[model samples]
Target: MKSLPPLGDDAVVRLSRQGGVAAIHTLTRPREIAFAQCNIDQRTRICSVLEGCLAIEDPASGRGDQRFYEIEVCYRIGEQDDRMVMKVPEDRAPGELVHLWDKGEVL
Candidate 1:
């Protein structure tokens, strides 16, 4: 394991842009992000990853709640399973995730 700087999302985006893959492991779950050769929209907080794009936003309705974030899976990667997408923690509002379809499969 290596020590990482505390730049938060900015650091993640920067590293991803630099062709670095990041794996984040916490007490609750583990996450991996690969941002190479992808488009990112800072205003919308959406970034293209692997074979699809993920959109994240702090809902306006949840003002003052720092822990509230909505994640939407715009499309599915090649043959990726829905079980993998549903692994997001329940507390993270997995139900709020809007998974669009891809190739006749729901993301």
Candidate 2:
């Protein structure tokens, strides 16, 4: 696993509220539309994890012009790189989950 440093609540919240939206726009160049906050987690009181959804032009082959996608941001305060993002397929069994890559593995 890699180092996953936990960030402070203020820093994480700032990124969630301000930086995240700008980043998504820069990456997607989406049409001017209001973004929506789908979820927010601060129960730990250490840092914030935010999940938001936005409509963007679909770049997938044979897809329509617009589609909704969710983005999640998690910041932990520590000195180990164990961060991971996973996409669980709804059609698959729960035990069928697999890691796409492990720390230090070549991409």
Report the number of the highest-TM-score candidate.
Answer: 2
The C-alpha lDDT values of all candidates are: 0.25, 0.24
Q: How many residue pairs clash in model 1?
A: 0
- Best candidate (score: lDDT): 1
Give each model a TM-score: 0.19, 0.22
Model 2: lDDT to the true structure:
0.24
Residue 7 in model 1: lDDT: 22
Residue runs of model 2 more than 4 Å from their true location after superposition = 1-63, 81-107
For 1-107, candidate 1 gives per-residue lDDT tens digits of: 12112222222221110011332323213222323323344212323221222232222423332233223222333543221121122234333122211111123
Residue 67, model 1, lDDT: 31
